[model samples]
Target: MAGTVNRVILVGRLGKDPEIKYTPSGMALATFSLATDESRKDSEGNRQQITEWHNIVLWGKQAEIAGEFLRKGKLIYVEGRLQTRSWDDAQSGEKRYRTEVQGNRFVMLGSRAEQGESPESPRASTAQPTRTSPDQPLEEEEDLPF
Candidate 1:
């Protein structure tokens, strides 16, 4: 009863193209905005639409894949945890707080053709083979000299 969880799952359209940035360490990070909407009948019998915007971030290999495949208006389903960060604006001198989804898993829900991907082609999500080695630990390091 003492455990806590911070998870967020969203299926939405990208508001704009993702921006990829690299740190000094040469790590890849991709940032994008997503929008989700809901429509329902209001008290006046009129349909009302409400939209929520979310900031999404992906790192490492996932970020690279997202940058290459995802685009504006593409519908995607993302499973991630919420993270809040603060930074000082350069010009405004004000503290900026940003909430973002640290995407761990993502699925392209829309048609592959729209993403410049072919339906006949095997995408990364569907192309990868599942791990069958249950007894081996995934984090076990290899003896690479590099």
Candidate 2:
């Protein structure tokens, strides 16, 4: 291959509300866990459902937006790249590594008038889409046409 691509796309439900924090530079960072389910046939032809969880992180303005709007059990589509980082454990003196998706863009899934949302709620009118760029201009995603 001439080059390698490190892209990841995920459509899943939020396991919990996004967590937001500010870096020393005052840049926003958000982290969340998404859960996806896969079904497979077992040896007896029985269907088995398995759930996989992914850690997702977004930076910059997108982080603030996600932290404010995204909630547990909300469905969303995320496009990003996979990254792994390592750190030394202070207690045990061992190296620890973790892999997570560094999200560039995300779009909320569902109708604007999703269940449990009031008609007058601001989120009810938004398609809930945004993109992150710490070093580049932020890009806004248009409402997805059903």
Q: How many steric overlaps are in each model, in order? A: 0, 0
CA lDDT, every prediction? 0.75, 0.79
**Candidate 2 residue pairs in backbone clash:** none
TM-scores of the candidates in the order shown: 0.77, 0.80
Candidate achieving the largest TM-score: 2
lDDT of 2 by residue, 1-146 (tens): 65667778899999999999999999888999999999999999999999999999988877887887788998888877788989999999999999999887777777656624566534421323334435434446545555
Residues forming the 10-long window of minimal summed lDDT in candidate 2? 121-130
RMSD of each: 8.7, 4.0
Model 1: residues with Cα > 4 Å off, grouped in runs? 120-146
Q: Which lDDT tens digits does candidate 1 get at residues 32-83? A: 9999999999999999999999999887777777788888998887766787
Deviation in Å, model 2, residue 102 alpha carbon: 0.2
| Candidate 2: clashing residue pairs, number | 0
Question: Per-residue lDDT for 7 in model 1?
Answer: 62
